[model samples]
Target: MDVLVLIGRVLFVVLFATSAVNHLTRSKAMAGYTASRGIPFATAAVLASGVVLGAGAVSVAVGLWADLGALLLAAFCFSAAVLMHGFWAEKDPQAKMAEQSHFFKDLALGGAALVIFAFFAYAGHDLGLMVTGPALSLG
Candidate 1:
């Protein structure tokens, strides 16, 4: 069980780290994508996404406040799957496949995050504060 948890944590870290790097390095593309999706502020949106991904990666990697990290990541994946991926699902075949693949992947990640959140909750991790509102508040 311990080994499994470690492996799961590692996997989560790797996933979020890769995503963070991608969002950071490809800010222009990401911003354009967000704009295409009708997001009001593309640059701000990309930066915010990068921050969430980075914070989640760090939290999961360090195993310090991982439940909050997981919840934040869950929100990220959920929004990406529902808003971004869902919008592309029926437009183009290749795009649709990619979006669907991402949708399922995010769904799986969200499930894993929930599991981690549940574990932490049972272990007395304070999750009430983690999920109170938006993961990032620009204001």
Candidate 2:
């Protein structure tokens, strides 16, 4: 049971951490794409999203105030889903499908984050409110 939880945590963190590295390393490209999508302050938004993603994923991986971490991720995911994907705005079926896929992916991540927050706040987990251990633990 503990091993499973630990593995899940690692897998979850990997997604966000890798994405953060991408955003930080490819800020210019991401920002340009974001601008193309009509999001204001595209560069800043991309940079900020990367920071939040990394920080939130790290916080959850270590079970350090995971509620806050989850909120960060939830915000980032939902916001990105709306601003970046916007599947409803697409007219072409193929394009809409692709955008919808991305949108749902983000929503799924956000949903997971919400569940994590709920687990800490209401699932009677002692270590969820604070930092319990390193990233490999099953807090």
Per-model lDDT: 0.74, 0.80
Residues forming the 10-long window of minimal summed lDDT in candidate 2: 128-137
What RMSD, rounded to one decimal, does every model reach?
6.5, 4.3
For model 1, the stretches where C-alpha displacement exceeds 4 angstroms are 1-4, 87-89, 124-139
Q: Can you give the lDDT of residue 62 in candidate 1? A: 59
How do the predictions measure up, each by TM-score? 0.79, 0.85
Candidate 1: what lDDT?
A: 0.74
**Model 2 — TM-score against the truth?**
0.85
**Candidate number of the best lDDT:** 2
- Residue-wise C-alpha lDDT for candidate 1, range 40-117, written one tens digit per residue: 788888889999989987776556676678788888989888877783547788878888998899899888887776
Can you tell me which runs of candidate 2 are displaced by over 4 Å? 124-139
**Residues 75-139, model 2: lDDT tens digits:** 89999999999999999999999999999999999999888767656642534334553222234
